[model samples]
Target: MTSRVLTCLLLSVLCALPALGARPVPAPAADGMAMLQRVDTARVQGSPSTLRTELDAQQAKAPKDPMPRVYRAFLALPSDESFAEFKALAVVYPENPWPHVGMGLVYVRWGMLKDAAAPLETARKAVPGFAPALWADGLRLQAEGKPAEAEARLREALTKLDIPRFRTDLALLLAGRPGAAAEARALLVRSVKDWPEQPEALQVLSRLAREAGDAKAGAEAGALLVALQPHDREAHRRQADAWLAAGDKAQAVKMLERYATLGGAEPAVLSTWVKLAVELDRPEDEAKALVRLAAATPKDPEPLLRLATLAEAKQDVAATEARLDQAAALAPERADIQVRRARLLLKLERYFESMAAYRAALAAPERPVPEAAEEAAQLTRKLHLPASPAKGTVEQIYDRVSLGLVALYLEHLMEKPELKGNLKVRVDLDPTGKATNVVVLYDSLQDVLITHSAHVAFMDAQYPPGSEPQVYQYVFRPPPR
Candidate 1:
């Protein structure tokens, strides 16, 4: 998708919550857990057959040690069939740290992150400074809405984390830290060199390379990842995306096509391939992909929704509307349904309807992801806007937002260079949209920024050329860390 569409979609998804709640659930007994620890006792003592006998003897007695259940979850993972079973164990033994961790593992499997958070947090709280729980909860927090907390958790996790995958996981989350990507990249380099078959390290390296604006490096890392993990669909898909982003559209098509042949046309990959086809305007290729999507998942609405996204991408307003209407009918409660409807309305210049649809999405009954919903609400606000125009049709809005009147305010400063700052100006205007007066309510927190110049600049900002501005106030500080 284009950056605008992606931004709009992200805005809708991210605004779905007030800081994530997901409180702790009831836990299983640790006494029972201790008893069940005997099963591992046999393993520790290097007795395999005796381990089964011990477990059987124990199961015959209590018939319920949470450890057996947790160990079972650990054994059943990634099969895609054990999610419900693991969930049941987690629900039945909520107090047992094992179940929660197992639940978190299940969440990772499905990429439905919020499910993992509460359990992982419970584990962290239960065993403060526990490496496994700390690392897992740190990753979960990163997935939730608090990056700084995630970083702190990860840092704490690293001090105690001695897992085999420690370096890889640390390298991945490290990329999210400001000014840490260089270090992360170096770490990943060493990790991949030592564990050449580790797809995660290569993937992190690839992403870091992309962030550093070195597409060739990204592509090389991506290609290496796919070579190592040919069966891993995500590696293939990321390689394709990296190739596309690196301006090698042809390579992207080839890689994606290869993945499709391997029964690896994930919704995201299919959507991406379709996007490429649309860009190429190769109707045959596009038609093949659409046909493949329909044949593979006739009951899935995602492909149809993707069709609408493609139409929106082309600015085919009527066609996009029709497609979204169809998709919404198929899956009315799907967030994507309302999101698409909003975007279609926005594309049609029906701002009010667009805003309503976005709001409906926010209020929808289905559990909305915190990040996604927050983003949606923000987008709806940005797109619907207020009843005033920042500029007329001819002039750019930014031009008007920063007017010569602001320069007048700067002149009024009558001082040496003051740090530039931002103050959100609310324009309450007359009927004709002229700003009678601009008020500055909150000064910036930074001494450098909240200086005389900032106050003068915001106070002097003019409304649009022919209209009044709305009245608003801003809380400001230096730019984010």
Candidate 2:
């Protein structure tokens, strides 16, 4: 079956609240009230198992009350047990439409549509205008693949029922038919507005909105569904799908994060979450998912490897190295691991150690990285302190000039602990290492002293003799620890 059909089936199971009557059936006594309260509470907590014992106790206490028996038939869960109770109640209370209504619902829920007919008809005959009987018959027709007939019954039920469940079920039925989207959407919009706390209604509405390409409507329904189903991992994941379909990637990530946090760490979901977080530039969310992925796949090195990249972005050298060490330990022969270690070591200026890592990467049984050889040779020259590349060449010229920029930043910007900002200087270096044009592309600092120092620091600074204008951007924060 398709996932959408499966989700609809699951939803239908919960929407089995039998429409009893037009008016509320008052409990005969206080204990009956307590039983109803507990049942409602248990349903809210998603703990139906708790209902059986409590209902049994209530049934035993009030053998005369038909309401407990009505609830039992609904919550009993065991198809046979629920059927027997509802059947017995139907006979015991032949005059009451509720028992017959409950029996019909039990039969419909258990897929015994054939057997549901007699009790549903009996209930309608007993109470001439009871909406629950019509709704029950609608479910039977729906199960029997008679959607047109089912919709008719449900619509009739709605004339008397006017409840969220009736409207949502009718909407579900209509949504499955082609060209019925507008009518279905209208019903759901009204359903949610009238019954704001009904998650099932909102869930259906959200999916309808998503299918219609109404992203704002979908997101609104998705947000409410998530709030309503905080403990439902699969519900959260499904909501994530709806949000994603609606083009709300950030909200989708939020729902996915909730799914993972609630123990829905399936590999596919985790992988998608990682990709979304990276696309959204949410490092913190990406890290959270990576940690969960690592826990889920203890022997895999990918999560830790990706985490090392995030650590490098934050400039946490120790943390980056620690992550790399862990990844390398897990997959020592993996060529990519060696390559990453080489890159980190080179960034930290440990040339000799980086050379070893790069060589190891090159020698791995896996094909060597394309740039490994050139990078290794470059490191060799750095270690030997070879003559600088000819002036006007770009060979490491940026690196050489960056040292001066860093020094200027430390003096003019870092000196003020309370001040923090960034500056971008597009330096046009003509031949002879003279800067002909120094344009301040951006300076958040607004400090002329720092701007002047940056321009002067690069001016007359020796570059490759004929280097083209190179734009260098720098951000100064409080001095690194």
| lDDT tens readout by residue for model 2, 1-481 | 3455345434433433344544334233233323533554467668877777777797678555667666766665336555655556555557667667667777777777898899989988987867777887898899999998999999998897576667878998998789998899899898778656666677778878878888779878878877767988998898788778778889888888889889887988988889999999999999998988888888889899889989989999998998998987888777778888899887876654576688788887663578877887776544432233223444455555555445545565545766677789887866766767678899997655456544544553567666678887767676566
Tell me the spans in candidate 2 whose CA falls farther than 4 Å from its real position: 1-44, 49-63, 110-114, 192-203, 223-234, 262-271, 292-305, 326-355, 358-481
Residue 143 of model 2 has an lDDT of: 94
CA-only RMSD, every prediction:
30.6, 17.0
lDDT score at residue 415, model 2, on the 0-100 scale: 57
> Over all chains combined, what TM-score does candidate 1 have?
0.32
| C-alpha lDDT (0 to 100) for residue 177 of candidate 2 | 86
Candidate with top lDDT is: 2
Please state the error at residue 378 of candidate 2 in Å. 8.7
Q: Estimate TM-scores for all models.
A: 0.32, 0.59
lDDT of 1 by residue, 1-481 (tens): 2455345334423432123344433233334333334433344344546655654565467443445434543544543434444455545444446656666766766677877777777766665655666766776777776777877776775666433245666777777778889988977777666555555677779888988999988898889778876676666777888898889887898788777877884666776777888798776577567656755666777667666666767777776787677766766666657876876675565544565566667776663544546655554334333224444432344344444324433443555344444454444455554445444554443332232322223333344456545433333222333
Model 1 segments beyond 4 Å from truth? 1-71, 75-96, 104-122, 125-128, 164-166, 176-178, 193-201, 210-220, 228-481
